[model samples]
Target: MPAHLSYDVVIVGGGHNGLVAAAYLARAGRSVLVLERLGNTGGAAVSARPFEGVDARLSRYSYLVSLLPRKIVRELGLRFAVRKRTVSSYTPLGDGGLLVGEGRTRASLAVLTGGEREYAAWRDFYGMTRRAAERIFPILTEPLLTRDELRAHLDDATAWRTLFEEPIGVAVEERFRHDLVRGVVLTDALIGTFADAHDPSLVQNRCFLYHVIGGGTGDWDVPVGGMGALTDALADTARSAGAEIVTGHEATRVDTDGATAEVAFRTPGGPAVDPTDGTVTARHVLVNASPQALADLLGEERPPAAEGAQLKVNMLLRRLPRLRDASVDPREAFAGTFHVAEGYEQLATAYQEAAAGRLPTAPPSEIYCHSLTDPSILGPDLAGSGHHTLTLFGLHTPARLFAEDNDAVRARLLAATLDQLDQRLAEPIADCLALDAHGRPCVEARTPLDLERDLRLPGGHIFHRDLAFPYATEETGRWGVETAHANVLLCGAGAVRGGGVSGVPGHNAAMAVLGR
Candidate 1:
């Protein structure tokens, strides 16, 4: 083997976590190198142009931004490029029913529900939880370990009593008279959690707590241009700070010998015999892929067995959807996301079928129209006119797609969605445009088996290190960050403190590396 290219740190995968880690490590004056398998950066946070010439921001797998710390963006000087968006979501019921809320509008529930008693009930539940968020946000951003430190912060007798010992359903039902209204508020309970929304688990309420805790209340925003721009900004920041990035370099194995580690990856243009052409050795290694990705590199010795998993489906629409309501002005077509599931029973049914490894026939889906917000997404010229694009995310498909026929599932999902929208909007499909050269429409399915088989998460569970109820503790969500191998750290969605584009896990892990 040729000589190893030594560095102070080697970050595998250039996703936000890896990029954040690289930036911090480089900022600390440690030599850092980031290896990415794809030509573009940002794993799930990436944006792609599904249609040529005409650009559409494909948040691809992960859509929307919540739980991201404003402090981290500031500290890292990430604000210059990050385009923040406030949320204006409307959950539409099949009839003319709708649940609308904007930017921490829990205070304005009366307006949202039109003076309904249900609005007051939700205000109480959200009010109490939002208050808890104010207290919890600061703690989550910082790293914690000491019992006294954890206790002095989270040991709030009052906060604990309200958060843990309460019937959340009753509390929520009291807030809104409309079951649909209460359902919309509660649906956020499982953004990345594997729990049911109505589950009596205090973790359900905590999901809401964590989202608003970061003080990023309101509609979801993108980082200008597209989701890829967020990664571009991070990449630019890393490179400007003197960090090195090598794309199309896939790390096959991470060889560790107690004290030091070496990463072996194949160089795209290099010879089959020269795998070492791209190999690098480092004092520290950070694994940013799913836990299963780490297990693939580290083997069963770490992560050891299956966890849960999640299925992601992405759709590229030819034209703007035909809504049922023609009276709704086109200008009123906001880029806000719309969640379809309305009540506890609806969510429960979806969850039970999903847990059983079968896709829900009528799945609860969340739809977002990015073109509605930034007409520039269509290009500089189309800024004044409304552009065309749509996104629909369905839940509870088995993580393992190897067994099922993906083509059939995709058609079924698309057909169901069109039918649902048509029934609601009362529109014809002849007006919609399906573009050519966009290549064949395809569906990407990842099953628990895929998460387990490829990502190596336990039982295909994506949160390899869960931080939810029963698993919520100082150590529970910590991932392997503060675990056995002090030099090794886990910094993905599975790690403690939970997932999303928050980048907390990576930021916290970087701090751990610095021993700060």
Candidate 2:
């Protein structure tokens, strides 16, 4: 006989979002079951020891934490904590670079551009975004607002126009005169999103809005114990609230009318998944997987493919690489975002090249050293021996570029990317790499295709799909997480206003169930 179970709600995919929904619903006296295809939960938000015999635990896929709400943290009593980054970012020019954060941003700006005009514009622009963040972030958990209602919430007409009305590139161009400053501002609109700065679709605008409004202050912080710590806390909260979590259960199908649902699954090496034996019935079903996966489960025709656009490289450096700029310390520079080859013209040229199906001559990328903020992720030996972890995320290298030969393309792309970074550093990054126990260099690169196969992110898109506005659309209900079937809800990154590490989708889905 195949294993069978029943619950008030069955969640397919035990990612952090699913765990959040499970915790909230279970706390409200609802019976919940979370099925995860992987042996462990947390999904992309996980930490792993990639290098052999390395004591360092790196936040593998999703690194920073900014979008998680304090309401969920308090309601669930999660023991998660995050540390503020001292430096905001560092973009290298020739001998001097533009440094942001730690009270020296103005000085750095003045030094680089030889004036305070850029700094003044920077303050005005960011102040606008900060105000917009305060107004827009609080409503993410409540019932979705219509576009007009959202505009009313954000009463500033100029702020609204800058973020929503015209292309984000227009605002960037009109606000800042320096090409470096303009490129730095435009980078936010392109992280994990493949789009031209002035794409008519306004996709870049949507992406820019999400990045700035995170946490109501637009500050992305380092998680205290890596990204896994947050999910671990959520899983604990859900379990304590009487939720059942089953790992290695791949959800195969969901048959549901408007009122009730039955979920079919198959475990690794298990018999064929059919409703007869390997099935569980539930009054409600919440899919915490990608939108494409959700369509497959509901047995609907798959939607258009959403392709991811980025390159991820993780390295265990024996020590931080020295920078070409001798004035700034490596620790301060690497603590925040270390941008390379991302000048405004460079970014535009790269996009044009990539759009034409060729790798950019100079790929734009950012690097972050997580251990500088929280050294606890390192073991005693590694922490004391000056070892640190570096995470590099490359832009403009979309998933389509790796379709023919992922390995060969990845190698060619990695070399070109490192070559770009090498220009900003005094020495090549390769010399600073620590060797694993197997004597291999402690560096690994993951293309979007690697992410697709590993994490089931449809087309390896990090947001699961292109993000939608937080407001209610015609296809959705009062809650952005709603689906066509009343009994089914989407609780994944694919939901509207549901990208990043935020549990907004999960929280909104739970509130929709609770009729809040």
Compare the candidates by lDDT and give the number of the best one: 2
TM-score attained by model 2: 0.98
TM-score, cand. 1: 0.83
RMSD of 2: 1.9
Q: In model 1, what is the error at residue 257, expressed in angstroms?
A: 4.1
Q: Pull out the clashing pairs in model 2.
A: none
Error of 2 at 22 (Å): 0.3
Candidate 1 per-residue C-alpha lDDT over 1-516 given as tens digits, one digit per residue, 9 for 90 to 100: 223389887888888878887888888898888888777678767776655554455666556665667787787887434344444565555534453445444543454466756655655555665666665666565655344454355556554554456545555554457666766766666554555654675655555555555553423565456666666777888887878988878888887874688888876665656444456788788877766677778765555543343445444445565454443332343356566654557767777876776666566756676665655556543444444555665555544432565556555655654455455554543245434355544324444554455433455554454443312354543433543454667767666675667777778778877877
Q: What TM-scores do the predictions have?
A: 0.83, 0.98
Error of 1 at 54 (Å): 3.4
Tell me how far the alpha carbon of residue 85 in candidate 2 is from the true structure, in angstroms, after superposition: 0.4
Error of 2 at 451 (Å): 0.7
Candidate maximizing TM-score? 2
For model 2, the superposed segments whose C-alpha errors exceed 4 Å read 1-4, 270-277
Candidate 1: what lDDT? Answer: 0.60
